[model samples]
Target: MAGRLRCPNCAAPLRLAGRVLRCAGGHAFDVARQGYVALAPPRRRLAPGDSPEMVAARETFLAGGHYRAIAEAITEATPAELIPSAGGAPLALDLGAGTGYYLAALLDDRSGWQGIALDASRPALRRAVRAHPQIAAVACDVWQELPVQDACADLLLNAFAPRNGPEIARVLAPSGALVVVTPTQSHLREIVDALGLLDVDADKQGRLHAALAPRLQSERRRELEFTMTLDHEQLRALIAMGPSAHHLQPRQVAERLARLPQRMRVGASLLIETFRRSGAAGASA
Candidate 1:
């Protein structure tokens, strides 16, 4: 809803007037025809986060529900009592919310909740807007100061996205929780070497928690692992949708995928951690 969005220029609450969102400070952001809006700082240019091709590949891959367990695990961890609400309506913020797949799943039965998909990519927002009726797509870099009302979000979800610990701590309400989903070392191990895909870092999660120690405390953790049967086509989408796509050429990727069997069992492993503000919450995040 417009009530949560603040102007990146003046930090004022945005009001929806017709198809435009304007703040009292006279800063206006136009809603795109695709049903989303850009809220990046007006003075700074955003480096296109994901290309249209990459976004398309990710959309196709997620639509197949290859990672449905990740979404389900997040929903299972957050009970009704754990989620905060604003005026009886829950608010969910998904960082690096590519296509808003996980957020859509979380809000499936919660009709009273609104989900905001924040990403730096315009291409991703195009599909994110249609992920759910209550989803509001905004284009903004997650590493910078989020353009949302302070302490307004009831829940924040970060799945395979960048984390801005300070900014995250600043935006979360006192009782709100932050759920982060990351891949374990075993994830994609079957095909990582064969396809030269990006390798998972086992200790990455450790560093993440340490970085947020000043403001957040991990409350719960879960490991969700499964094997998915993916054909060459599905495998290609998985490859093209992530960081490896940037390092590999189109021909190289196609050639590598061709070497795979008709169907390959790919391991899907993830570590989900739920965190809430710590005793140092008042410290400058």
Candidate 2:
């Protein structure tokens, strides 16, 4: 994984030596004991990704298999056949890969696939590194220039996270595919209404298409819709695991949860879409 990384400062190839990764130009980053690296630039103005509490909640909820259907859809939708065989092991870059749950499942389905789980949060990367032995986790801001070299990744994954269109285009191999999972307007509507959480923007899809224009062309799109009957604990974890956690206080969340039914049918709806580098002939399955 270190071999695949470049120095964010100099864009020089990095080599792992003991606990440090150093480039020929003398730039260095220390690898954490838990086996993840930080490549984000020293100064950042934006708030950090997910906090420890959020990551913990997410880990717990995902471990219970609440989102198994969505994870399965992503794994099945990935076009592993399109990846070039020239690379020793095809690399799958999981951008904003919190906890690496989806990437871990994909690696399990695709033999010989290696993963790089990139996130802006150290807490998320800590868990991501342990998700699979084949995964190498990196803590870096996706909004900035990625630490990855050009045209190296066979598959780039962005699931319910911010997208960096140009960075994604630059890192993906010509024949590679990009998989994104976004929530539709009706997704988790019941939960949102019940707790007064943030709403999914009505024009999110249109905005996404505009953002990717002329750089990535759509290859496939699938809508996964399901219902989960969640108990109080499940519901609480679900809320704590998402953006709502940032807005609502613990007392407010508890009050809302207490008013809701003990068991409720929650809608889980998401769009799993795939794209290819613009102007590249669609790879045959």
Per-model CA lDDT versus the true structure? 0.87, 0.89
How far out, in Å, is residue 62 in model 2? 0.4
Every model's TM-score: 0.95, 0.96
Q: What TM-score should be assigned to candidate 2?
A: 0.96
Stretches of candidate 2 exceeding 4 Å from the true structure = 44-47, 283-285
Candidate 1: residue pairs that collide:
none
How well does model 2 score by local distance difference test?
A: 0.89
Residue 96, candidate 1: Cα error in Å is: 0.5
Off by over 4 Å in 1: 83-85, 279-285
> lDDT (0-100) at residue 52 of candidate 1?
89
- How close to the true structure is residue 157 of candidate 1, measured as C-alpha lDDT? 91
lDDT of 2 by residue, 1-285 (tens): 777889988899999999999999998899999889988666654339999999999999999998999889998888857655336789999999999999999999988789999998889989998999899998888988999988888899999999888899889988888999999989889989989999998888888788787788888999999999999899889999898898999899999999999999999989999988777768323
Clashing pairs in 2: none
